[model samples]
Target chain A: MRLSPRTWTLIILAVLIALAPVTFPSAFYFRIGALIFVNGLAVIGLVILFGYAGQISLGHAGFAGIGAYSAALMPMHLGLHPALALFAGAVLSGGLAFLIGRPILRLKGHYLAVATLGFGILVFIVLNNEAQLTGGPDGMAVEDLGLRAVSDALGLGLRTAEVWYWFMGLVLLLGAFLALNLHTSPTGRSLRSLHNSEVAARTLGVDVVRYKLTAFVISAVYASLAGSLQALLNGFVTPDVAGFLHSIEWVTMAVLGGAATVLGAVFGATILTALPQALTVFQEYEHLLLGLIIMLVMIFLPAGLLPSLGKTLRQGESI
Target chain B: MRLKSTLAVSALAMMAANPAAAEIRLGAVLSVTGPASFLGDPELKTLEMLVEEVNAQGGINGEEVVLIHYDDGGDANRARTFATRLVEDDEVAAVIGGSTTGVTMAVAPVFEANEIPFISLAGAVVIINPLNPWVFKTPHTDRMACESIFTDLTARGLSSIGMISGQGGFGTSMREQCIDVAGEYGIEIVADETYGPRDSDMTPQLTSIAATDGVEAVVNAGFGQGPAIVTRNFAQLGIDLPLYQSHGVASDAFIELAGDAAEGVRLPGTALLVADLLAEDDPQHAVVTAYRAAYEDRFEEPVSTFGGYAHDAFWIMAQAIESAGSTDGAAVRDAIEATTGWVGVTGEFNMSPDDHMGLDLSAFRMLEIVDGGWSIID
Candidate 1:
């Protein structure tokens, strides 16, 4: 029986999430696996913002920075649990996106990009300057999410890495599931139509501004949640989390893996996240090789790896 | 497809052929690229050179010393990822590096949890404070640098002081330490101002310091171009007060950036910077001179204090391995803690339970920039 592509995507992701650990030589791979899922979650948000809505956000890492700092500060200052801080950060990020997107999303193309970039730099400066509150650039430790204690209470012994791997895997699945459902929804169709041409979509009775704002708010929440999870996993967060380079990394991850598809974003995140650890074998020449790969990929596959590879495979099947 | 499969096969083979028990693996993660490369590049060269030297001389404790290294690109997440790979997959006996304080702090927990010795090259007290058993650092902590300057100021009877620091982590750390350590030395910080790290002109902050009452000396704490800009601005503004700098600016790059304005500026730094000027009887003189000669001969660049930290880290790890008589992590951790009276390019080392930073104020020497070069004073 032939299945729909979305269903196949979900099935493949679930099976890979469960069975890939069988190849691990040690528990260390679990940490890398968890890192991939955390990064994939963020890139999935990029898939919505950049892939679906066709908007550019060079400063999305700013929302991540807010989420990370919230995870570190809320529990210490407001006497809330780290788990609760995660939701609080997501909510706050969504609210900030709603407020900022109203004005910034009105501008098109590079102007909008610059406005978002300015916002990101502002957040980075605040985090760097507020020495007393945010611990400045030296970074501050975060309270644990207390998952281990709860697992012990339930009589399920698990390593920290294993627990995080499972937790992030579940979160990424939920994120991907939501993103896939949105791919066929009315809002998603409006977003895609506007992405094709704003004037045409507006003529067709689509609410251009509202759809764009919705995409921005939803993507901000995803990025924020990913940042919160990362801070909790590392037990530390720095101003770099919100830096412009990290924002670029998320975008690059989306574009590198075929941003239009959820599976592609996951593939992009996995490769980008794990490639460094794998490249350690190259030592000094790692950067050189990484640059070569990026250059070669962009030059050869303009449509990105996943989409282009899928086209090739389909062509081969026809042949 | 052939090339990809071949690469995978070789990788699998490499993993299958793990190091024998007779081999000891030492891992280093440094920002060999990106913004912090100025610090990490010298460190990477020093470690690469020293690893070859040790391996040439029959390795540490007669076991082949295999160096596993990765470039973190000065990113904290990359540093954390590399640290995990080093401790877990590589099975390194000890890990060294993370060239900046932020990167070091990010990976300290991984090394701590895995029970591996992590000798950081960065200068942050938080890495070892609250006492993580597995982590230690080679550079003098930011708190130590603050106390060193304050001690010199108090000795000179300059009790009233002012400070202008950058907004970076290093600057923030020193600012807090200066304020906290001032009361201990009976000194008063009359003025405190800060500038952004990218600010080319610190004239406003320096002007504020100059206008403060009873300010006997102005100290600038920062790395990169920020401190040099402060010095140039101080000279340009013709501030008459003595200008002090932290050890963060102990390099020829600072002098070049500040031009003649850097003359007569005093700071506390390791003896390695002014090795040739040290007295023959000085305990650190011979070791410092040897290290300076070897590093300059190999890398063909004047030795930096950051490289000296790596030099000390290498010897410290080597000494711990030799003393422990094994490649085991816990054994090496205990051996490093019990380290005493071991001298290196930086200072005489003595590690203890409470004091992971073994060197005291004695490790630092009062240095003055005379005619665009370092001269040991007092």
Candidate 2:
């Protein structure tokens, strides 16, 4: 039985997610695996914005911050269940993107980048300085999601790391499936049309601005959901969720892994997230070595890891 | 399929490469680089030197002690990852490290979840206030510092005072702690002012503090050059009221920054600052002077209370393992909780189950800056 490419992507992602844990040295690797999925979730959103629609957003972490703080704050303040707060964060992020994307998406090139950068910084400053609410730079603790407790009550006997590992893996699979399906859907086609050339896409009767905004809002929801999961998984969240560096990191992960594909998001997020954990043995030289490794990758794989590797494999077949 | 098989083979091979069973593995996740390096650098140095000494002395219980440490780069997120790595991958008996309150709180849940004993070096009341059974710390919390400062104020008969604090983690938390406990000390906070971590001039804030009625004295809760800048501003304003600072600025660099204006300023400082001034018979004098000499000799850097926190934490963990007679996590935790009258660089520690920090206000000595040097005040 043959599988469609979309079905093939989902099948591969699911298998990899299940199979990777078998190689884990211990339960600790589960936490690292979960960290990759969380970051990959945010990077997947970037793939939709930058990859599909050719729109850029340096403030997606702002939406993430809103989502994380929603999980952290709404549970404590408004007495909302944590799972419910995640949906609230998603809706809020989409609404915010809809409002801001209208004005900011009109810019092109570096101007858009700088404008988005300004938006990210504004969110970070507010989160950091609002001491009364956010706990200032000291950061605040998050409520537990209680999934481990539920698993224990059901006699599943799962640890925190393992629970998050399987939960986030399932979330990543669903996310990847949706993104892959969107790649061929009408809206997805419209987004891709705008990505190739906005002027040309408009001449083809596609609402380029509307498509771009749709991608922006969709990506924001992705980032926000990822952020909420990160908070719940780690059982803590700081203003760093909305910091400028975090916003930049998501884009870097998306682009480095071949932003054009769903699999690329997983690869990029895993490499960037797990590299430091592996390199921590370097002690004082960790940062230096990390920079060198990243630089080498970009120089050699200019089109990104997945795409470049796929191109090489295709050429080999032709030969 | 090929990559999966290869990865499984490698992972199996790695797991088979475990260390000797007789060796006691102690894991650490420290901020040995980045913004908090001043604190973590000396901590790493202290741990390295002490581990070498311990292993050289025929080890603990005739078995070698192995130290497995990771540098967090002062990032709280990395701290959590390293915490899990310490407990699960390395599978150490207990952990000792956390350079900042932010980092400590970040990893506290990891240790609590795994039921591994953790001795934190960070100085935040929250680290110990809630008192997780598996978590303990060495440094005097900010609450203790605030209480120590207020004690001096009440003794000096200064009931009314103005306050200025920085907006960073240390200052902000310490300021809140001071306000929370001020009523207990009979100290009335008449005026409040603040400065950012990078503010060059605090004259405006200082001016407001001085102009406030019944402002008999001023207390500054901050570290780094923030207090130095405030001292300069206070001198410029010539308010004439007594000025007090937190232990955050107890180092000599503050004296250098404030220069002549540092005279007559009092703050809570560790006994390490006045080690030479302490009586030879004093219990803390020997411990502090030895640590100070050893650290300064080995690292070629001036000793700091930050390093002292690590020094105490290492000994506390070592003592717990020695007393427990085994490296079992629960056994070592109970041993640590049972600690009492243990003398180290920080002070005499009297750890109880309820008080994980184990140090009291006496851990902080009131030191006055006179003639551009620290003077132990009675």
RMSD of each: 2.7, 2.4
Interface RMSD, all candidates in order, equals 5.0, 3.9
A48-101 per-residue lDDT for model 1 (tens digits):
988899998988889999999999999999999999999999999999999999
Write one digit per residue (lDDT tens) for candidate 1, span B284-356: 9888998899999987988888898999999989989999999788999888889899898888899997777
The deviation in Å at residue A20 for candidate 1 is 0.7
DockQ of each: 0.41, 0.42
TM-score of chain B of each: 0.93, 0.95
Say which docking band candidate 1 falls in.
acceptable
User: What's candidate 2's DockQ score?
Assistant: 0.42
* Top model number, lDDT: 1
Which lDDT tens digits does candidate 2 get at residues B1-378?
A: 423432332242223225568888988888888778888888888888888889999878777888999988776777888898888888888898988877888899888878889999888888888879999999998888888888888888889989999988788888888899999989899999988889999999989988999998999998888999899989988889999999898888999999999999999999988888888888898889999898889889899888898889998889888989999889999999899999888888999989898887889889999998999888
TM-score of each predicted structure versus truth: 0.95, 0.95
Off-target runs (Cα >4 Å) in candidate 1 are B1-17
